[model samples]
Target: MPIVNVQMYSGKNQREKDILAVAIIEDVSKILSVSEEEVMILFTEAPHGK
Candidate 1:
């Protein structure tokens, strides 16, 4: 399993997060030669400069 961590400022909505998840799954699946379901993504939201 491939674990990916993504950090961003805390202001994104559900749609944006969904879009990012889809895109990340696609690219990671291709790059890692794994299925979309096998890839794991962790989204972290924090204030700027944290």
Candidate 2:
């Protein structure tokens, strides 16, 4: 199993996240020669201002 951690600012909407997740999963799966189900995307978001 491959775990992909994505750290970013907490501002993206659900649709944006969905799009990004799909793209990452597709590319990662193809490059790693693994199934899409095996690729996991973890998003850690940081809020703006302290």
Best by the TM-score measure: 2
Q: Model 1, range 1-50, lDDT digits (tens) per residue?
A: 99989988989998999999999999999998999999988999997674
1-50: candidate 2 lDDT, tens digit per residue: 99999999999999999999999999999999999999999999998887
lDDT of each: 0.92, 0.96
Question: What is candidate 2's local distance difference test score?
Answer: 0.96
Q: Estimate the TM-score of every prediction.
A: 0.88, 0.92
lDDT at 26, model 2: 98
User: What is the Å distance of residue 24 in model 1 from its true position?
Assistant: 0.6
Worst 10 residues of 1 by lDDT: 41-50
Relative to the true structure, candidate 1 reaches a TM of 0.88
lDDT of the structure predicted as candidate 1: 0.92
Q: List the residue pairs that clash in candidate 1.
A: none
